[model samples]
Target: MINLRQAVFYEYVDDGVVEIFDRYKWGLRRLGVNFSQDLLETIVYCPHNLENTFMAFCSWVLWLKSKGEKTNPEILSETLMQALKSDRGWIPYDYQKDFLAQHLDILESPQLSLWKAAGQQLGERLRNRIISDISEEGKINFHPNSILTDEEKEKIEAFKVYIDQLYL
Candidate 1:
């Protein structure tokens, strides 16, 4: 099982998932807006890249720190929607570089390498576990029409819950 209390960027990202939902919930509640858990989950895990995820997370941290002073639903939705947009020609920028450096410039410094390494390890673990659980009895055989059984799906969902806990 993954440890949520670990002082690692990946762990922080996991916590960010939880924090984002909490912030969204509070923001919507304050705005008197109705929302569903599925929508929250979609946005929470919607970012397709590490940079976007970090950006969304940074926004979450900022919003959380703001307390109830600035809980505009329109602004909240816009910020989160921007985070989910595809990065076209925008040059990648690590805004959280100061908080958890990921710049892999060997000539510059290596302190941020720890975050990079931890991210890689955590990502691999998540990928491997998902693949293993989705396979049939540890076998990788699958046809184009592969469809998970109800029991298999349930188990996969359970595994996801376990993985989600790693974020908190």
Candidate 2:
């Protein structure tokens, strides 16, 4: 099994974010003088907010403008699609879509209570795993792999006798 910490923190390191940035740079290069350092940095460090999304879209437009390419929504859409497709594994599209859809208008709705309740339930589940608090029923659930074979049980019995003899 993969170490949970390593899996969770994979995106924060140089090997992860740097590699994705390098690929985006390459795609921009193909379009000529394609990306700016500021733009790259903003994309790397910006929070996933509407303002930052708009900034990223503007950066793409600027890059296209520099290349004498048409600056339109289609161009921005194509660039974003390319960026997403090239880094699908690192960037989970489905989760992003769902989170954005759910939270984008959360401040405007009375359904915030429902969202809070759901979040609380998820928090409790995570807490249970961290504390390793198993119920009485859980203790009754024996792992088959941990069971001793007949031969192993006999050896254990012999070892018990050997210890008993030392006391005698």
Candidate 3:
């Protein structure tokens, strides 16, 4: 799992130095971005009103993809929120609060806002999704497969399949 990484590290440090500290584990490839398909699959399936929240988010993706331009985090976030609110006349304040809280903190670097960057965040968010930690959150970081009705599950599965094809 770590041959390349080890070689790189040892190239700088001698064998004796490494023996002095054997507990450390070197992992190659820092955690920076996520895969496009993972985020698409998660976004459509992660609860928060399929018609309103899900469709609005999808529209944001489609819109960004069409533009094919780079954007900083601030503009991207504002544009996405504006699009969502404009589509429904009004977006719930609770959802907005939760969305920012859940997604913004980890964006230490400037966000790309393109479909790929937006999609990349989905995996980290899903893996980090915790019921106890985000009870008050109204949107983002949600997956409730066991709690869904059969019809709801079908809708989520179908949407995930559709988006998966598009991303590929």
Compare the candidates by TM-score and give the number of the best one.
1
Per-residue lDDT of candidate 3, residues 1-168 (tens digit): 222224442234433323311211110001112223333233223333323443334334334444785545445444433443443433335544455345432222211222233345334333233222221111223455446557645654554565455335
Query: Model 3: which ten-residue window has the lowest total lDDT?
Result: 23-32
Across residues 55-129, which tens digit of lDDT does each residue of candidate 2 receive? 243354444565688644445545654443342212334544454344333222222332333235434443223
Model 2: which ten-residue window has the lowest total lDDT?
A: 133-142
In order of appearance, the predictions have TM-scores of 0.26, 0.23, 0.20
lDDT at residue 13 of model 3 (Cα atoms): 44
2 versus 3: better TM-score goes to: 2
| Global fold similarity of model 3 (TM-score) | 0.20
Say which prediction, candidate 1 or candidate 3, comes out ahead on TM-score.
1
RMSD of each: 16.6, 20.4, 19.1
TM for candidate 1 is: 0.26
User: TM-score: which is higher, 1 or 2?
Assistant: 1
Give the clashing pairs for model 2. none
When sorted by TM-score, best at the front, the candidate numbers are 1, 2, 3
